[model samples]
Target: MKYRRVKPWLVAGGCLLMSACSLAANLNYRALLVGVSGYPGLDAKLQLEGPRNDVTRMRGVLLQRGVPAQNIAVLADGVPGAELPTRANILGQLDRLASTAKPNDYIVLHMAGHGSQQPVSPGSPFARDEPDGLFEIFLPRDVGAWQNLPGGKGGAVQNAIFDHEIRAAVDRMTATGAFVWGIFDSCHSATLVRSAGGSEEVRMRQVSPQDLGVPATAMDRATPRAPAGTVATAATAVAPSSGAGSVAANRGGSAFFYAAQTSEPTPEMRLPAGHPKRTSHGLFSFVMMQALEGGAGMSYRQLSQYVLTRYGGMNETRVTPLFSGTALDSAVMGQDAATVRQWKLTDAKELTVGAGALADLEEGAVLAILPTPISGLSEAIGYVQVSRAELATARIEPVDYAGIPKKTDTELKVGTVGRLVQQAMKFSLSVGVDLQQCTRPCAFDAPLTRLRNAKPGEGVAGAQVQWVAPGQAADVRLTAIGDRLWLMPPTLGGQQACTLRPMALKAACDDQMERSLVSITLGSLASPGNAAQTIGRALHAASRAANLMRIASALASSPTNGQVKTSVAITSKGGRRTAYVAGQVPRLEDGDKLLVTLENTGRVSVDVTALYLDSRYGITAMFPRGLGASNRLESAASDSFELEIHDDTLGLERLAVIAVEAEKQSERADFSYLAQPSLPSETVTRGGNEADGNALFRDAGFAEYATRGGRPAAVSARTGMQVFSWQVVR
Candidate 1:
C-alpha cells in the first residue's frame, strides 16, 4: 500500500466530488478517486510517488464525512481490484456519473497525477477555444508521448484527458440538477517562476509541455506557458486519495477548486506538517480534508480560504490556488474564512489589475502589492494606487516606490494578487480655472502655483490632483467673480464635464437620491479665505471620505476573518432574550437592544475592536472606548459588547468586530481614529468631510476629525473583521 518517492500524483484531470450524508435514501453521495503515480512511457525522472496512500487518505476522509464504503469507487495503478486509470476508464466513470446521478444526488470527483499541456494545431477544430492554442491535460497511467497528427493538423497526446472534455462531463451531471465538486490536487503546468522556499519534502504535480511533445516555439508564445522542463522532481510512492460539503460555484450546481493556478505547480509534501510519520500527499488535498473533517458548514469561498491559510501557516508560499462560483456565500459542509477580493496582476509596467467597477475599485484607491498570495500585508513589495478604472478592469500605478528595488516592478511575475489598503472616491475632483484675476501672462497662476507647491502631507486628496488651465478632465471649475472665488460644476472650455451627478456631493449620497449639481462660493477672498485654502481643504476631505468608505466596505474581507466567533442576541424590554435570526433583519423599536459576543477561535491571541457604522456618514468605535485601553482577547477567551438602538438613526446600521493577530503582548492595531461624528443628512455641501465641523462638507475635503498619528503597525499575523449589519426600521 506504500511506496517511496511521491511521483507526480496525477489524475486524468480534476475530479468531481460530492459530500457524504446520513440520509442515504434521500441523497446519494458518490466519488471517483483516480490517482496515478507511474508513467512507463516517460523517463524514471518523471515518475511520482505512488498515490496509493493518497487514495487511502481521501477514502478515510469520505468515511468520516459519512460516505458509504459501497458508494466509493477507485481507479489507480497500484490499488488492488481498482481499474487502471486509463483515459477510457476515467471518462467511463464520468459518463456513469452523468447518466446515473439523480437530481438530488451529490458527487465528488478527485484526480491526482501529472499534468501537462499540448498545442492545438491552427487547423484543429478546438484550436480557437484555446487562447494560447494549448490544451491543458492530465496524464493517465497509459498516456503516451505526444505525436504530430498524420495530416499535420495538430499534435495529440495519447491517454491524456483534455480539460474542456472534463468540463463538458461535469456540465452533464450539473444539468441533471446534481451538485458536483471538482477537486484537483494537480496543477495544469508550471508557468510561475518560483524561488520561494519551504522545509517539507516537496513533490510537484506538473509535467512540462515540451516533455509531452509541445513545439518549443508554441510553448514560448503561450500566454501562460511553462519552461523547457517542469519543476517536478521524482519522488518515491507513499500514498493514496480523499470529503463532504454546500460549496457554491459559478456554473449552476457546480464548483471547481484547483490546487494551483494555470500558471503555477502545486506540491505533494509531508502533510499535517509534523506528524511522526507524516505521509506525503498533495498539500491542497490534505489541508482541504482537514477543513472538511471539522464538519462545519461553509461556502466554496470559505473552503478556498481555509486551504490558503494552511499554505501560509506551513510556509508554502509559492503556489497560488484558485476557486470560482456564483454562490460563494452559500453554505456547504466545511469551515469558512474571510473573503479578500484579489485580482491577477497581469502587467507591472502597465500596472493593471483584473478587477474594476464590479469589485468597487476606484481610481486613486491604494492597494498592498504582494509577490505571492501567501505574503501578508507586512510583506508587500510596495503599495499601488489605481490610475484608471473601468467596468470590470482597472489600471494601477505604484506608490511607496522605495519599498521595492529599482527594477522590482519590472520583475514582478504575472498572477500576483493586489490587496486593497483603502478606497479612493469614485472619481477624484480636478480643479480647472482661468482665474480672470491673473493675466495669460497669468492664467490661474496664483491658485495653481500654491497647489503645485503644496506638500504631500496627511489628508492629501490624491497625488494626481490637477488644476487645469481651462479645458481637460476637470471636475470643478473656479472663476474669480468680484473679490470672491466662485466654484462652478462645469466642464471648463466645454471639455470633460463632471461625470458625478452632484459634482461635490456624489461621494456623500448613500443611495440614488437625485441631488442636483450645485456650485459654491469660497466666501469673499478679501474677508478671510484664499483660493488656495478653500480649494486645497476641500480636496483633502473628499479623499479621506472615500478612503473610509472603501475600508468600511471591506472590513470583513480579510483571510483572518472566521477565525473569531461573533454571535448576536436581542433583549426585549421585558428582560426576555432571543437569539438573532441569521438573515432576518430586526426591526428595533424603542428600548430594544442588541448584544454581541466575541470569542477568539484562531491559533493566536487577537486584539478585538468593535465598531459601529450608521446610516448617516458616521463611524463610532464602541469597544475599548478609552484611548489607552486594550481589547486583546487571548485564544479561547471571549468578550461582549451591548449596543443601544436609536429611533432617529434609522436605516441600515452595522456592528463590526475587527481582530488583528497579536505578534507581541504590547502590540496594538487601533483604528479608533476612523470614528467620526455623524454628518447631518441634510448637508450636501462641497468637501465631503465625515467630521463635526457643525456640518461635514460633501463631495470632497473634510475638516480634520482628529490628530492623525494612529494607524496600525505591520504585524506578522493577519487582521480580520467580522461584521453583522441589519436594517433599523421604525
Candidate 2:
C-alpha cells in the first residue's frame, strides 16, 4: 500500500493528539523521476530522445513496484539534441512536487543528466576530475569549448547540489514528517563508475502463470513478458555497487531507494542519433526495470543478486542501486525489494506531539503523559509525569536543561506516532525550596542546655566550631554555645554542627542540608559528659559533644601519626552522623580538648571533612569516599591513606587527643578555629591547551594515561564537585 502525509489536530491541554494518520505511516510506491541527457561540450549533442526513453523505462519499473502508471511522474529534460531546461525551472518543479508531500510521505527523485568538470573560475580548461574531487554536470550544447557561450549563458557543468543545501531541504521537509529520496546518475569526481551485471542477458523461456495479473499468453506490447527461466530471475533487486545492501524494498508506508552512493557517480549511455524507436537507458535504470518487470517476487537483496549475476555475464554496461530511509509504523523492507509486498499498519490511530509544543515540559527527565485522542489529531494528550531515569538516558543533566520558566501551566504536544508511548513524552516538574542557616540555634542543643541548667530551654548556641587535624593546616571557627557547639562561618553563621566533621564545601551540599540540623543538648549529646552535668554546666558542651565515646575511644588508639580515621553512625533521632580523628599530634598543644559530632537528617548523601583548630592553628583532613564506603582519607597535604582500628590498636584512640595529653603536663591549653580550610588534593589541568578536555590530578599517571588512551574524563571543582562530564561513545 502507498503512504500519504496526514496532519493531526491539537486538542485541549495539549492532551489530545491529531486523529489523522501520520503521512509517512505506509510504504512508498509513487515517484517523480527526471532524467536529463544534455552535455554541452565534452562530446557531440545527445540524440533528441534518449532522456525521454530513460524516463519511460523508469515509469515501467515503478509500475512493477505496485505504483499506478498515473502515480509515477516523469520529467525528461534535453532529449537528445534538445536544449535542457534552465536550472531555475528544474529546481522550481522539484520544489513544487516536494511541497505537496506531508510528514510520513516518501518521495524519490531520480536525475540522469550528463556530467563533466571545469575550473571554478573562467579562462581555465575543462577539468574532468578536480583535485578536490568534484565532477560538474555539463549541459547539452557546449561544443568542445571551455569558454562560456556568446549568450553569456555558456553550457557549463556544475557539481551536483551542495550538501548544505541538500541537508537544509531535507531538514525542512522531514520536519513536517516527510522522507526525501534523491538518486543521482551523474558521475561524481570522488567515486568512479564500475561495471555491473545486466539483467537483459538472462534469457526467459516462459512467463509464470502466477506472475500474470493479466493474461500471460496475450502479452501487452507495452509490458514485455520474458520466458520461464529468465522471468523467474528478471527483477532480481541488487544492492548498490557502492556496498550498500538492499532490504525488502517494499512496505505499507514511506520508503526511499537510490541508485548510487552520495560520493559515487552513475554512468550514462553513449547513444546514436536519427530518433531510433528503441534505446537503452543508463545501466542502473535498465537493470532496475528488469527486476520490476520479471515478477520474480524476489527480495530487494535477491533482485540485487540477480542483477549482479546478469552483469557478470553481460557484454553491456551494468550498474547497481542503493536504498535507505525510514519506514512508518511497522513497515519492514528486508533485503529483497520484491518481498517488501505487505504492510502491517494497524488502523489504531497514532497521535504524535511535536517538540515545538513540548516547551513547557520539564527538562532532564522522562515525562510520561497519557495520550488523549483529539478530533484533528490521532492521539490525545491527557496527563504527564516526570521520571529521572529517562532524563539520565537522554543526557538531560540538570545543567543542560533550562530552568523552569515562571509560568502557571503549559501543555506539551506529541506529534504523530505509531503507538501511544513515545520516547519524546513530556511532563511537568515543579521545584521549590525552604532555606535555613546554621547560625540559628538548633533544636537539639536546647534540650542539652536545659539539662545542663544553662538558661531554661534554648537550642544549641555557640561561638562556632569547625573540624581540623592537629598538625595539618585548615581554616575553620568554633564557638561555645550553651551545652552544644555550632558552626560560625560568617557566610552561614551560627548553625549547629550535626557531625564531628566539616561539610563538603558545595552549593548542592548546602541545599541538601537546608532542612537538616545537628545538635547536642544534655542527654541528646550521648557522651559521658552528658551525665547530669555540674559546675561550668553548658560551658564545655562543645568539647563534650565532640568527644562522643565511640569516636574518642577509637581515635585515641590509632597508630599512624599522619593517617586519619573516619566513620559513620546512625543517631537515635534517625540522622546519619560522621566522626573524624587526625593522625598527627600537635606540639605545645593546649590542655583543652575539642571534640564534636555530626548527624544528617536530610535526604541527600554527603562526604565528611575535618578542620582542626590548635590554639589558633588550623588543620584540614578529608575522607574522599563517603563513610562506610571506604576508611581511606586523602590528607590535605599527603597522598590518600587508610586508617583502621584493630583490637590491640584501640589504645591509639586515646593518644590522638592533643590537649588530653597536654593536660597531663599540668599546662593551660588554648585552641581557636582558623578561617582557611584544608583543600583535599592538588588541582590538575585537562590538557596543555584550552581545546583539550581531558584532565587528571597532579602526579596521577593513571588518569593521564587513560585520557590519552581515549577514555572518558570528568572535571572536579575546588569544592569537590564535578563540573564537566565526559563519556566515550565508541
Candidate 1 worst ten-residue window by lDDT:
234-243
In order of appearance, the predictions have TM-scores of: 0.44, 0.28
CA-lDDT, candidates in order: 0.55, 0.29
| Range of the 10 consecutive residues with the lowest summed lDDT in candidate 2 | 721-730
- lDDT, candidate 1, 1-730, per-residue tens: 1112211111111211122222233456788888888889887767777365577667766764456777889988877878888899989998898788777676888888888767655565545445544667888888888777776565678878987677667766766667677778776765423211212145567787767766665554543432443322210010010001112112236556777655456666554332233456776777676555432355676566555544432323345566553344555522222234455587745768876643346566667777765567777767777777764468877665435533355655556667766654322334556455522343234544667666653223332354544433233445443333433332112112222112332332322111111122432222221445445554443334333433333332355666788788998666889986442334455577888888888878888888776544356888766788878878899888888876556544566576778887466766665565443322222343333342233322221211133222222227665545555544
Q: Evaluate residue 96 in candidate 2 and report its C-alpha lDDT on the 0 to 100 scale.
A: 60
lDDT of 2 by residue, 1-730 (tens): 3534333332212112332223232544346666655433232322233445667656644543444555566656644432244455455555665566565465566665543232232232322112232223323222233333455432322323322233334444544555545544443221222212111111111111111121221212111222322211101111111112222122212333444332233444322101122243555555555444332243333344333333222211112334433442222221122221111111123222232111111222222232333222223233222222211011111111112322111243333121212122111111111113223544333333343343522222221222232211111122224434322211122332232111222342332222111222333334333322321222222222222121222222112211322222212122323332121111111122223323222232223333231111112232223323422122332223233212211000121112111112232211111122211111112221121112112113113112342322221111111000000000
Off by over 4 Å in 2: 1-30, 39-49, 63-71, 78-85, 117-168, 190-278, 296-306, 315-730
The CA lDDT at 215 in model 2 is: 25
Query: Against the hidden true structure, what lDDT does model 1 obtain?
Result: 0.55
Off by over 4 Å in 1: 1-25, 194-200, 221-252, 333-730
